[model samples]
Every structure is written in structure tokens, then in C-alpha cells.
Target: MKGDDDASVVVAGVRVGSFTRDSFVDRVLTMARGDSTRVAVGVNAHVCNLARTDARLREALSTSTTYADGQSVVWAARLLGGHLPERLATTDIAEPILRAAAAEGLPVYFLGAAEGVAERAAELLRDRIPGLRLRTHHGYISEGDVSLVLDEIAAHGTRILFVGMGDPAQQYWVENHRDRLPAAVLTCGGLFDWLSGSNRRAPAWMITSGLEWLWRLMIEPRRLARRYIVGNPAFIAAVLRQRRHETPRRTPSGVL
Candidate 1:
């Protein structure tokens, strides 16, 4: 909130902030140390495609500080003649974020994931990050009964809240409750699974070569097949169409 330079790029109609991992963590901590409320969200190809038709999700993203969580999204930013520092996947950067919060003595909350997943993640993080004041609640609560969870969060005096309910649901919850939540709220899809050791990250080579999607597909083929097979192609096509419609800029020489 304090150091937000408002630097961002629009890719396929979704806005993503241009911040390196370091800068991003710093900004979120800054917000956590502040009195004002803010929200952070990460956008991937699946999120972009979903936002194409989900007006509420679009609004949620439009109002939050958005970042590129997908390598494909970073690639699309470049293709659109814009630049994102790099992909800042929440799982990849969770350590630094949590460490910073711990260092700052900020109380943090982890809300989402299966019944025991969040609690396990908090336990591991507490061991890894000493002085980390963290709490958790499973994401299985009924939508209409979120007030109880909100009350628990407020009682903890949380300064940074991470929600891993996934996609539109997480974003929707943040948007609907932003006013009531204090400090910084971030939407972290599947982060709890990775942190709790229920899921593993792709191998370094796959991640570096941007084949992590393939790895994820391999690991959870049935659950993610449509998302990768269909969503990936659709995202490419959408960016291509956006590229085709844009008029190219000209130099003084007027060479075309």
C-alpha cells in the first residue's frame, strides 16, 4: 500500500503487476504493517480464461493487486509488448513472504485447504520461521457461514492473511470481505497443498523450461486435463486475437 508505484501491465484484458519476487514480498509486508486494507491476487492462464466470462471474478481482480502466477502469463505479457519481471507463483515465494512477516512480528492467518492441510502448513512454517505468529482454518466452511471465520481472523489480530481456496472462490471471498479484513489479504491457489507436503512442485528442469504445467497434468491428469489441454490453447488464441487487433506503433522514419 505504501510503496505501490502502480506499475502493472494488461495481458489478455487482465492486469498483472510488474514486480519481482523481492519487491512483491516487500510491498505485501509494507501493507501488513499498515492500517489500510489491501488485497493481492495472482493470475494464471486458467484465471485469465475464467475471468473472461466471470464478471465478479474480473471485478475482484480489477480491485486487487494482481501478479503473474503462471509462466504462460509472463510469456503472454511479453507477447503483448508488455513486461512482467517474472512469474511470482505464491508457492514459490511463500517462504520469503512468511519469513518477512515473521521477522516483522506480524500475526498471519492461513484460511483454506482441506481440514488438516492449513494446520499442517502452519506447523511446518512455525518450525521453519521462528517467531511466526500464524493460525489456520479449513476452507470447508459454508459460504453463508463465513462470519465465524472472519471473527476468528479478527481476533487473531492478523496482519497478513493467505487464502488458498483456489480461483474464483478465493478471489470472491476476498472481494466480499476486503472491507472487514484488516491489513493485506492474498489469494494463494493450492499453496497450502504444496506447503503441507500433500503435493510436490515440478522438477527444477520442468519449472525452468516452463513445462511445469505438463508435470501438473501428469500428476493430476483427471483433475487438470481440461484446464491444461483446453485452457492453454484458448489462452494462446485469445492473446493472438488481441495481438491481431492492435495497431502497431510507428517510428518517425515511418518504416512499415
Candidate 2:
């Protein structure tokens, strides 16, 4: 159900896969070849902090092949004494995923994003990744329509599904429908907007410098202020608390 040595690490009881971007794409390609179904997800500081309070989101992650999608989360893992290798940010990785699907001839479904965004993203991907078998549906989907969407994906033989509705909503939809969807599901936050050029990403310097959050905050202050300003600090506090709890070491006498 998971990739080999998936590098799954637990933070505050939520599991996150630590594979490099390349390794993740390879695993998806292999899964597609075998027609395996799984839920692929990602995490950031806000998501981690949310999981601490949101049992539903936490439970959903516990069942997924998750990744640390934010550099800040990776750094927090290190601060908590976890051996996370790097950031697996979704924006940086979506292209490689599409490329893998194109090469392997995997049928992919794009779900979520505003009206027409998913289709636009699909068109962009097909143009860039020749031979990509892509389909799309906008986020106008409602609760009553979930089963219909599942049937559509299954009937079309979708191999990989990307859901970009953001946060717990995206994760919840995939978790609830994955059983009937017949494809590996990826909870890709805002990936469509980035790919469709509806959202502008920061320069490479900002991303590498771990200030991508700042750039996003600058762009959508009203929307993301609480996530970065409040959630980031809370995540740091949780990691430091985890670190403290790990520190009651054995004495040199070899006894507790």
C-alpha cells in the first residue's frame, strides 16, 4: 500500500513520507504500473499544527503516504530530532508527477480548484507533458456529487488523482472517496492555481531560502495571515516540546 522504505516519519502522531521529490514520482509511476490505489498527501506547519487539534485531519493523515510539503515543516522535524531529508513542497513536485504520468501512460484526474481551473491546469499539463492522459473536474463538486465523481474516475480507469481544494477539505474528500475512486489520490494544495498561472510563485531564491511562506503571505495576507503568523509559531512550540520530552537521558551510570 506504500512505497518501499517510504521514509514515513511521525510528527505529533501524524505520518509523513520523507522521500525526495524524484523518489516520490518514481513510486507513483511504479504504483500506476501495478494499478495500486493509495492516498498521497503533504504537510506544512499549518497542517501539522492543525492535526494536533483536528482529529479528523489527523486520522486521515495516519492512513496516507504523506510528505512534508513545506520547508518550515522539515526544519521543525529536525528541531524535534527527526531525520527528515528535505522539503517535498507540492508546487515544486507537480511537474515531475505529471511527467511520470505522461511517460507511463497513466490516466490522471484533476479534481478541485475554482470553476474551470482544473481544466485549465490539465490543458497546461498536457501541453507541457506530451502524452499525459489527463481529465478534470472543477471544485464546484458538492457532497451529494461525490459518488458520481468516484464512478466517473473508476469508469475512466484513472490511475492517479490530484485534489487541490486545500487543507482538511481536500484531504477529507479524498479519504472519504478513496475506497471507491480506484486510483492513487494526491492532496495537492493550490497546485492547479500555480500551474494555471492563477497564482504566482516566489522566485527560486525565496523558495530555497525557506521564505516561500512569506511570499505567499505577502500575496494573500488576508487569506493566509493566521496560517503563517499564528500556526507557524504554534508548530515550532510543538516541535520544541517534543524535543524537551526526548531529553530525559540515561545517566553515565547506565541507569535511569
Candidate 3:
């Protein structure tokens, strides 16, 4: 095992890449150039942490390039003997990638989020990325209705698809439909809501310190209090244990 230096690593037969937000977009663009087949891109964090439990998901993640979406994950990586520069929030990553896609003439499709959110997000993205090919599919459809959604994407010639219905669901959707779509899929939880102006992100300082979770808890205390206040602490404890027991792996560049 090599140290982390923005390169890919194979864990449990899956190839996982250590990427910042910028590198993630670049790599996906690279993948899109050769084959517009569906590819999964994860924004790593504790809430969406599948690396510890599910071997397939870990392998899927390893085979895909996972970006450090949350500050907590980046901090944990550093603590667990990996070197990472910063947290690449998915919300921040989406627009820039869309802009790049537009510049390169790559068509993008938005999947997930409530009715109208996807459409609104497309509009917002178009404003930023002029002449960008953007399409949307709402999140309220029935599970059996996925075939219709798949058909729409196939017709659109979508090179990139953003899944914003939150994790596990978004992750599952991408995994289940990767074979049917001709696009690279990135799981972006709640990003559509933020882009559509329905949800406001916390201040930069809070995000930098990994306390954005706290800000979210404050916004919807009754809903998120238990998850962040109690669940996250336990999650942190588990990560600490894993860090202590696992040996640091060096990267191909020899950095640990």
C-alpha cells in the first residue's frame, strides 16, 4: 500500500482514489472522454461511510475516485496516517464541474431532489455555465419507474449525471443503474437544495472546522439533533479506534 498523494488505491479488490474536489472533476472528465458509461463518484464522510462495513461498496468506492467531501473525513484521514490538503464539499464542487463540462461541450443530467429542485438547479447551473447542456429528473418517482428515468438520460446523451437525493439512496441509484446509462454519475447529497436556494450553507469558518454539522443541527434541531449530537460522536469514536489499529500505508510517491 502506498501513501496518499491524489492517486488511486485498491482496497478489497476495489480501486479507491484519494482526490480533492478539483482532481475529482478532472478525473471524471478524463473518464467521460473515453467512455460515457456510468461511473460512481463518492464524496467521503462519516454519514456516508461505507468503507468499513460493506465490502462491495468499499470496492465500488475503491474502483471509483472518492473525493473528501466533508472536513471530518479529511481530518480523520490525516489522523489515521494519511495526508490530505482540504475538504472538498460537494456543493462547492458541482458548479465548477458543470462550468467545465459546458466549456468542453459535455452534456450533464441532474437526477434526484424534490419536484422542481432538479429543474431549478439546472437553471442555476445554466446561468453559471452558459450554453451548458443540462437536463433534470425529479426525486419523487416510484422505484418501479426508474426505467422511464433511464430512458430519458439515454436520449439526452448525458456525459455527467449528478445524484442529489442523499446517500445510500443516491449511491444505490448510481450503482443499480450504472450499466444502463451512458454518463458518469456522481452522488451529491442535498446539493440540489442548496443550489436551488432552498437551503443555506453555514459560514466558511464553521465548514472549515468541521462544525457545519452543528450548524445543520441548529437549523433543524428536532430532526438532526440525535444524529449529529449523539450518533456522530459514536461514529468519531469508531474512527479513532480504526486509526489506532491500522498501519499507515505509503503511496507510490513514498509519502505517508
TM-score per prediction, in order, is 0.92, 0.90, 0.86
Clashes of 2: 1
Rank candidates, TM-score, best first. Answer: 1, 2, 3
Model 3 scores what on Cα lDDT? 0.68
lDDT of 2 by residue, 208-235 (tens): 9999999999999999999999988887
- Tens digit of per-residue lDDT, candidate 3, span 1-256: 1223645432222233476666667767776675646455544444444455766665456445565666766666666666556767778878878888888999888888889988987887788778899999888879789899989988998888887776556666677777887647778878888889888889989987788988888888997677677766765776667656767552442120
Residue 216 lDDT in model 3? 83
Model 3 pairs whose backbones collide: 2-250, 2-251, 3-250, 3-251, 15-62, 15-63, 16-62
lDDT of 1 by residue, 1-256 (tens): 3213445666777877777898889879877888878888888999999999999998887767777899999898788777777888888888999999889888999999989999999999999999999999999998677898999999999999999888888888787787889788888988999999999889999998888999999999999999999999999998898879975221111100
- Candidate 1 TM-score over all chains jointly: 0.92
What overall lDDT goes with each candidate model?
A: 0.84, 0.76, 0.68
Better of 1 and 3 by lDDT: 1
Task: Please identify which of the two predictions, 2 or 3, would achieve the higher lDDT against the true structure.
Answer: 2
Worst 10 residues of 3 by lDDT: 8-17
**Candidate 3 or 1, higher TM-score:** 1
| lDDT, model 2 | 0.76
Identify the candidate with maximal lDDT. 1
